[model samples]
Target: MASRAAAVALCCLLVLAGCADSPVPTDGADSPSATATPGSSTAIDAPPAATPKPDAVEVEVIDIVDGDTIDVRFPNGSKDTVRLLGVDTPEVHAENDPTEFPGVPDTDAGRNCLREWGERASQYAEDELAGETVTLSFDENEPRRGYYGRLLAYVHVDGDSFNYGLITKGLARRYDSSNFQYRERYGTAEGIARGTGTGLWGACATESPRTATETPIPAADGGPPLWVSEIHADAAGDDRENLNGEYVTFANAGEETLDLSGWTVSDEADHTYTFPEGTEIPPNGTLTLHTGSGEDGDGHLYWGEGSPVWNNGGDTVIVRNGSGETVIEREYGG
Candidate 1:
């Protein structure tokens, strides 16, 4: 009877041990059967990591407020209004603010002219900015962030620059006190436009007006024929030896064909070369002159001499007509 009781007790103990070893489902969602194996353990499954996103390029057009101020669009899809630096167009506001002598044409004609200038300037801006990626940098002195919390950046477009173009065309005047990056270049272009009276200056008649005078050249349906715009010294090596060669290039800015026969290129030293009889420069084409040349080097004029006559460091080159009148005179600074 005692032996029988011992066997029964041992069986009960084994059953209790098996129940303790079995895994219990922690939550109804997970299966109790799914568990780590003994000896060699299994790893818990985890989610994949996420990839980071790239930075955005900032750009804005704000609005074509007048000819200078524009609405800038921020990277966060926010809009901020900005005034352009280094240029001031004629005010279109209706303050009736009158100047001392040659005030802005308050008359209908003057007002109309101002409006036209504004339209042209806007068109130029669109031509420059549309479909381009840009970065906005603001002037330190000017409000870096406008009242609306928009970043005011000085626009640098495609590396060529547009501020200078506006000033050169007399569309905008220079703001001297402003720390404009292209101030000098813009100032120079403004001076040239004012001197030439290309745009608004041509309409104004006042002497010593608010703006400078522009000298008007008669409108030419076609511009000048083939004309040389640049010259460079074609010397090779450190010896600085005069390669006995110089080149004169001609550019035809007009639409008509320019015959090159009688045209001559001469230096102040009187070394002259007449164009070959049949040479012709098509509309908007370039013609080069060279000597002992195997085909013109890159189509630029090449004059290969046993010794070069034109000074390598610098010298004056003149293009002339058959009549000996000067067409263009360039001093080669190279």
Candidate 2:
């Protein structure tokens, strides 16, 4: 009886061991911490890094001149006029010069249409950038200022290029894009703008670009056939020390020789230089007038001023015939 009872007890122990829960899975999902709560997590993923903005000089816009121009005030109490680089809007001011508009018809109606589009461009800029803080960037290959004495720079607002925005919106055409750093990017945007008929290209009645058939004759009425071709406003060093480095270049686009005798070249400050009686520019030739005193020859004239004549900041070049009629107007720098 005692042996049988012991045997039963041993069997009972074996059965009890077999019925116990398999060893708790401590290494996996069955572990007490994992199974107890799926609601909590302590790990956190980090955020991505932010991109850096390029360097630029911050300035406040004082006024909007037009679609492509604006007046800005620097941190110093000084001010300047800035011409939007790499883009040329339709001319609200250059109404009489129909030829300036490449595809616009050479008619009163065409010029009117062009000016209307210019107004729209101006309004757009006013609405967006008027009196706002905008940054400016210069092109290393181009002049810091134009012949007109306006600051030549790319305007940036809210980290985007306003100059490029104008092109993509069709408000302006690529002005002097060959030397521009973003020429290819601008060209691509221009193609898309043209295809979509964005702004001026869509609003104005534009014709296909016409090929030049013949040389355009000068105006029969003695209108000045001269235009400001180039201006070296800033010198390598100090402008006052290096006067010859700063100069304005005038070119004759007419077929006939131009007699600049008695014509006065003046700046916005009214610092005037009257060409000597025999100053004649041959057709398709250029006459560069330097700021420093030098014997005038070799397609060069001298302004004969000790101090700088053109302002490196901003100014306009006005050329008028003896009769005081404004003939040539070229503005740059700011």
The TM-score values for the models, in the order shown, are: 0.40, 0.45
The digit string of per-residue lDDT tens for model 1 on 65-107 reads 6566666555445555555555666655533222311334556
**Deviation (Å) of 322 in candidate 1:** 24
- Let me know the TM-score candidate 1 reaches against the reference structure: 0.40
**Per-residue error at 112 for model 1, in Å?**
3.5
lDDT of 2 by residue, 102-208 (tens): 46577888778778888988999999999898877665435544545455677877767788778867787776433544554455455435434567665553653
Query: In order, how many clashes per candidate?
Result: 18, 13
Tell me, by TM-score, which candidate is best. 2
Estimate every model's Cα lDDT from 0 to 1.
Answer: 0.49, 0.66
